[model samples]
Target: MPIIDNPIVLSDASLVLIEQKKATANFSHANWGDEDLQPVRREIREHYRNVQRLVCVYCLGSVSAHSAAGAPVEHIVPKSQHLHFMFEPENLCVICPDCNEFKSNRESLVNPVLTANRVNYPRNSALYRIVHPHFDSYDNHIAKFNRLYVECSDKGGYTIYICNLNRFFRRFGRCDELVNDVALAEQAERFFEDGIAPEQP
Candidate 1:
């Protein structure tokens, strides 16, 4: 997937535009209203695509070099239930078609946002709090062992199962075991952070 190398989130006004144009954004290619917004959408689309290639927040796989990517700006907390975060630039992320499909509306357990009592991260489950993109590091929530970043020791097994990182790997490929997925994800994280190339992987 495209990795967001250096993300400089847009201002709140841009978030307002995103919120105002939410429903029709898909149809309009994010040009829901205001003639001036046309340029904003164009830039957002372009930047989202580039960011996906430059850096990957959690999914460590490198994007395919074959085709142009689908640059959908994903809501880290999801927009369907959390209306307030519809335009949050910090919540926005670029993901590949496969990762997007796997993540499609699938609620994250231990939502970090709701742990802080925000409406952005919904209470998807009664078990684990949602993991927030705004807070909580993936590493802290899920510690790396053999090849999997299992749930942090503090949270227990329920929280690890809650995150559903395994389902993510299954959707991509059987690259690792449940534990291994966590490890590989951590590997990908280090890869992105340390500037390791695919040549080494």
Candidate 2:
């Protein structure tokens, strides 16, 4: 994941709808009509896919519009927990299904009251306990080894733990087995090509 510029350009009607929802305290996605919700949903996915280069903002997982599990629009501050920011552009990001499912309604704010009082979207990453896609650069926190996630900062560590980044590695041995086998095959290839084998102890 990288710090991607938000490319979603909400239509005037959509903005009006958001404002109306805010005024009415009606932030439920299920309640919105197809005409209002569908376009916004489509635009969100399209723009984010382009801006994020089709990578999940949380785990850097590959996301494809054509995939069985397509990228989902995620609320950085869960809408359930922060209704005021339900439609805030900065609060929205695209994430993989697994990350989204695991992170449901999980709070990320360093201070809820401070975050809730923002007149405008906050730009300071320090305000958040987790890496905010809008406010923080992904590489600054997390280091990656193939599919393995390594935390370089507290935010990265928290994000990995909350999202269960190593879920596959923990639930199954296939990841390690596949990686080890690939390494072995590559090593054998190098030996065969060189017509030499290094001395083994």
Candidate 3:
């Protein structure tokens, strides 16, 4: 499934607040936590949590349902770098804390050459190095085998690396209990074959 099937829709009040914030000369990402925006943040978290089926967009880990902190609202493009996109729905998603920390403020653009010239948020998957939660299908770029994530493409590899998708394995050494499931392994192997096989003309 795609990470985010639908983007959050802001209410009129929320839209007004965001616009008002942006109009201010001192507006910055730091204001993301302002008390007035808490309601907006909460709404975004709940919307994405449901749309992403409570899974971290990067590692596919289960998102915490008990608390808002469990699933943080992620800015695909670091809000600090592009404060203009802070309220962009396409730029937002909810992810597990581990993935969030690992992916913090890293460059996500496919072309570093365009970084300085960037003015608008990109909508094309080809413009991103990471698997875009909204624009790219997760299965097309990555395959999962039990606890392991296998990249189907460069974007998938970048996503896995940037997010430390194998964090569990790194923290906990490989053991019999962590072995890949036989059925899932077989499926993953087929996926690898399909991913690498040359397309018929």
Candidate 4:
């Protein structure tokens, strides 16, 4: 690995030079990345498959679930801003290439906090109530549709506005099964929670 030279890095000059170099080197072509460097987004598929099973929550399907076993992991928070969320385990979810390339460096992903049955945008609900996978659960906003596409929660609607899920979903059709799966998973989680009987705080 190469250590960055501190003296060679000027503050403003460094940010600009780095941005230009990264863009040119990575996005030489709209969808292509520089062969020489690692594609940051590849973390979606690479890490999950290494440790855990890459199953589609909606379809309950494995990598083999799709025609190809090469689905890329998507950053619900978009790695561009939440660089911290870049490699978060909860951020890793299996999605086809179409969805991946479409949603690049975007934001406004819905948090699955109190979402059940269907995701709802409770933006008017409260503050510090932001959507975060590591801190929150996707079960709130992401619903698995008939093994088709992922449905957005009420709050998810706001998220899609930013991420352009509408435009994308139009092409893919309704993700009824995906939504149902999320509802089922949420129910199970609730059952386990209630069944366990939490210790009083």
Candidate 5:
């Protein structure tokens, strides 16, 4: 899938709350889950769950439709390190619990120099080493064969590695039932035969 075409638009009340939180004397990532922000967080999760079609951005697995715990809001640039971007719409998306756990607090930027001291979030896809759910197309960076994932670019490799996309394979071992799809295998073969080169990091 490509970048989220429509990011969540916060209501005025939500924005006010965010602004109030930002203005606090000792604001930190811990404030993210404050009681006042619970509604906003739920809205974010619901919006992204629909927008992402109930699919995890990292591994394309099914996300829960009935529970917020099934799909949690993800900060493309971790909020722990960059609290200023905690509510940036472009930095938000929904990911499955596995991707959320494996990718916890890991740096996603391609170059820290570009983000240091910056007031605004980076808009350019090149600034991110991982496949950006907001700026990059998932298929352009990674190709999938059933449960197996193949990297088509540096961003793909970084995303797969960070999220451990192959965890299922590692746990169950490669079985014909998982990788024996003739159509998918042929499509993957054609993807390589087309001479597509990985994007340079």
Candidate 6:
């Protein structure tokens, strides 16, 4: 994982839809999974996927939007606890399904507070116990070795524990995936030269 610059700008239509949903749902959990919110979810997922180069934020695993079991928009702050950040762009990022499911609704920070009086979104990295995709760079806190996810800082360790990133690699062979990626890349090079496409795995 590396430092990712995510520029999540919502369209005017998206803003209007969000306001309508907020009014109807009264900022409840219902608003988070509303049918009208699918567009927003898609937008967030696509944006982060691009920014993260289609890799999982926690494990650096490959992800595909086309795959049925692909990346999901992860809430940095659990929406169940902090409903106010349900639609906050800075609170969202795309991570592989393994990380998403393992991290579901788990509090990853110490003294996690949502303040309305703040002038802008919280920018203090020290406030968060986990590695923040927006506030902290991944490489600065964690280092990866083949399939192993190792933490170099407290935040990195907290993130690994919350997401069960090491367990995910143990369960799913990341080395095998890397081999597959390399083979696919080689096949692509051959296809460009010989005009022959490889069969889908």
Misplaced by over 4 Å in model 2 are 23-35, 67-69, 173-201
Q: Which ten residues in a row have the lowest lDDT in candidate 5?
A: 192-201
In candidate 2, position 149 carries an lDDT of: 63
> TM-score-based ranking, best first?
5, 3, 2, 6, 1, 4
Model 2: lDDT to the true structure:
0.72
RMSD of 3: 4.1
Highest TM-score against the true fold, candidate: 5
C-alpha lDDT of all candidate models, in order: 0.48, 0.72, 0.81, 0.40, 0.85, 0.73
Q: Which scores greater on lDDT, model 5 or model 6?
A: 5
Evaluated against the true structure, the overall lDDT of model 4 is 0.40
Question: What are the RMSDs of all candidates, in order?
Answer: 8.7, 7.6, 4.1, 12.5, 3.6, 9.1
Number of the top-ranking candidate, with lDDT as the measure: 5
Model 4 Cα lDDT, one tens digit per residue, 1-201: 001011111245434443554455343323323343233434334544433344432223444333333565655555554443333345445554544555555544434333322233222332212233234334455433333224335543444444444553566666554456765556445545654221211
Better of 2 and 5 by TM-score: 5
Q: After superposition, how far is residue 20 of candidate 3 from its true place, in Å?
A: 2.3
Q: Where is the poorest 10-residue window by lDDT in model 1?
A: 121-130
Cα lDDT for residue 79, model 4?
52
Task: Summarize candidate 5's per-residue lDDT along 1-201 as a digit string, tens digits.
Answer: 374878999888889888888899899999998999987898889898888888888998978998877888899899998877899999999999999999999999877766867899999999998999888888888877677788989999999999999898889886575457776667656767994533311
lDDT tens digits by residue: candidate 3, 1-201: 466878999888889888887787888999998888888998889898889888888888888876978989999988887776889899999999989999999989877556645667788889899999999988788776666677888998999999988777788868344344665555656666766421211
Model 3: lDDT to the true structure: 0.81
Error of 6 at 91 (Å): 0.9
- Order the candidates by lDDT, highest first: 5, 3, 6, 2, 1, 4
List residue ranges in candidate 1 displaced over 4 A. Answer: 1-42, 45-53, 63-69, 108-130, 143-149, 153-164, 167-201
Query: Residue pairs in steric clash, candidate 6?
Result: none
